[model samples]
Target: MSGWTWADVDVAVPRPGSGLPGVAMAGFRQRVRGDVEIAMVAHPSVTLFLDLSETGGIVREAGGTSRRGSFVAGLLPGRLRTGGQEGSGLQIRLSPAVASVVLGAAAELTGTVATLEEVWGRDAGRLEERLRDAPTWDERFTIATDVLARRLAVPSRVEPEVAQAWRRTQAARGRLRIDGLAEEVGWSRQRLWSRFRAQLGLTPKRAAQLVRFDHAAHLLAAGHPPAAVAGRSGYADQSHLHRQARAITGLTPAALATAPWLAIDTVAWLAAPRT
Candidate 1:
């Protein structure tokens, strides 16, 4: 039960100058002397891990399958199992608003983890090589930002109205009502639901719940009591929060308060969106 030392998580935070909306970059180099397991809690953004280690080997279990190499993980409903002792890479988070355009893929990848090779083909390998060759973390960040910008040049943009809906839902911290979201977007409830699911890979209700769960989880991790976390996060009551706790991370609020993964996030993704 050794704790992670600073050396275990050499981190490079995201560059504030990079103005790429919906994209954040962090550089991580890790070395493990023993086995470690991490719970990949549900999150609102799509995640991409670009392998930069000497060996392109790491195991990710999500949606009943294990994937290796640099990979793209869509928004998930619950934790995934990450079993690996060593690896170093750039982890990127993309809001669903623009993930499809940036990856040239679909948000339909929800609950699934697929290799970067599958998503970006040989280009993915080439990008990894470029990032690995960069002399410093700053250099890597610049390269990643440039690559994403290039990919976005010829983008597959989503509808502006749907994008607005997603942004509003996020701003509300998942406390949004679908009917109200539809009203704000000036679309019928049924239309909003179908279009949101079609473009974002998640139904509006599920997205709201996921966002709510994320806020509550972080509150618990920050040492807030479950009752307070529940009230502030829009849960009906403490009991409601307990149900979502099990649903999102398979742990009670008490257990999640000390989750190692969330602890790592403090330094590893310092600027990542929590709400």
Candidate 2:
């Protein structure tokens, strides 16, 4: 819990095992120097637009996926099995700073799923332009970082103690107790939960659930057996692990095992906890 430092910040490719569903990497594609790629993606549970930039209005459909060709800024978590017309822009991965800057101060941003309609509601074209035509990747990242940082009333409101406790539990295979973490912070459970929810959106225990599941996915992707993965990833058993996977991702472990890209960002996000 020292202040935020570069040592605490990191960017990583998606970890294959985190059981959360959908993709981990966020990408932007440009055909020319500035051509935008926008499309609608249909998942089993949700249908959303993968609007990368807002311009030139050339709509194309690839397979079941439709490319509406708009602009994009922030993308939420979900299964992305569809694609828009390919573009040339680099899809840069974000650090926690970037997530925090773009997402505001919601510790757990679940429940509210992000989709194409949501982007259109916010008029994402402006930000999409910035991401597409920005002179450098750093420039786009910085702008995104600044936007979220400014939107959230308190950027560092997420308690380091809470995150640290969650991190410790994750490192220990989700065996850390909430009471132990509360004592370390010198606060009662009620107080800690309040602060944790307000700052990060989810309670410490729920955060631990996310961490545990993320680890489960990573282990599974690494070729561990289901029983072994369940035990190591903090599940009660194979059934327990299967239930959690379905609840979070709408996909069974068997389906996910074959999907290398599934829940790719969930692992990256949890492993870092930067935002």
Candidate 3:
């Protein structure tokens, strides 16, 4: 059996066609794992993350943080580093509409640190603790929503071009081809990649890979063979899937498959709009 330790609850509602969007729920504890390395998590949506105090990383509002045995940096758009496994919290997935506005506003944020005193009504550490202790999901979401609302006073003005492109990407369901995606978006490859990086923390290719990896992980957990998972997830083949899995998560498919703590709850409440 895999010795890795991790657990998570997906409270967000599943999007039609796409299983989950605009948010993701997760919790993990790296007891004996190697420094719990997580590949850069990049998505089109602006991610509002709550890192419980057990986590610690230097955050560059744009670059990213590398600390502890693990490294988590706030890539483009927005990110929160409240700190480790003890720092379990929610990741508020930002729709492109929400992302545009917040990114614009955050461009003017004074310092490197993600400020919370004024907007969140308190600091991140305390908020993390509060959420952890909250008796019910509703109470936790309420606090989460309150924090976002206060910081994002203005809702995003939707960008049809970007939004449509994002939809098309989703339609491909993690099996998107970067070259085709760029063409479909009507932008040159370089331009699309640049825009994707600016708006989201990852290049289009990286994002797709993550989606595929996540899918494969889920499939493996469901008892699918690596070869089948690879084919289903649009990988070149089983070998490709194995390499990608190790590259992205620092764990092999078989390793993750047998891990004792990989089971994560997939529930809608986890995705409910933050309070």
Candidate 4:
């Protein structure tokens, strides 16, 4: 039997090649022989969890709702967890900027977990079948990339100014001033606020908070002291960090440090090169 540990899982990423910005893909196969469960922390991305397992597929739970098989998780789906008997899947992370175009429903998807079928209709089932049938991880990655590239080619409904503002907010690690972002994007503050919320599904301020919280969460998981994390992540102080951590994740800084969801990030995300 395969060991019931993250270290026993096989992780794969796409081969180096030109690909869309604001998108990353990783493939994961659990080596464990039986049941598995994992708590998922919030991240500042719209994530697609595509199940390609031959046996039981994955199930996700959030906001007291559970969805089985492939699903799309919107930004900041709070306190989520996933489990299954044993399974393998591909995870695709899309920045909100790109998700607005690729998903064509980023604003509607915010803060919710929807079955892949809900998002892509019959195409969801077809895509999962193709991925499952692929003989190798590399082939699956290529197929996923091609699909995403095609979707991204659709004309974006997001304003260039809004996309630019989101990029700047992320580049600053959420430390940027919203007014400055509006100025840089050549939009009035009101226009930026309204358009950003309409197109990206969250106000600029909330987006910044999510980005900042994500950074702080990773630092805590990496074994940094909460006080140090607060300072580095731009919170006013340790207490400020504590409040934000609780608000965003409903977990204390200490608990977040040991979160199982983040534990695999080094293997599944950090080490993998983005396609």
Top of the candidates by TM-score = 4
Distance from true location, Cα of 80 in model 4, Å: 1.1
> What TM-score would candidate 3 get against the native?
0.59
Candidate 4, which segments miss by more than 4 Å at Cα?
Answer: 1-4, 271-275
For residues 217-253, could you state the per-residue lDDT of candidate 4 as single tens digits?
9999999999999999999999999999888878999
TM-score of each: 0.92, 0.60, 0.59, 0.94
Error of 3 at 81 (Å): 14
> For model 3, what is the C-alpha lDDT against the true structure?
0.50
Clash numbers, per candidate: 0, 24, 16, 0
Better of 2 and 3 by lDDT: 3
* lDDT comparison, 1 vs 4, better candidate: 4
Tens digits of per-residue lDDT, candidate 1, 1-275, equal: 26755456678876676647788777776666654556777778899888787676456777677666788888883558765557677888888876888776556678777888888889998999998898898888888888888877884667887888888877888998899999999999999999888888889999899888888888888999999999999999999999988977788899888877677677766555421
Worst 10 residues of 3 by lDDT: 69-78
Measured with C-alpha atoms, the lDDT of residue 269 in candidate 2 is 37
- Residue range 1-275, candidate 3, lDDT tens digits: 12333433223332333322343433332333222333232323344555533444212223364333222223232332222333334545555444445445322232233433333444555767777677665566666656545645775444455555566665665687778887876878888777665554456776666556766776786788999988898889999988986765556888766543234423322342111
- Clash pairs of candidate 1? none
- Candidate 1 vs candidate 2, lDDT winner: 1
Ranking by TM-score: 4, 1, 2, 3
For residue 184, model 4's alpha carbon misses the true position, in angstroms, by 1.0
Instruction: Supply the global lDDT for candidate 4.
Output: 0.85
lDDT of each: 0.79, 0.47, 0.50, 0.85
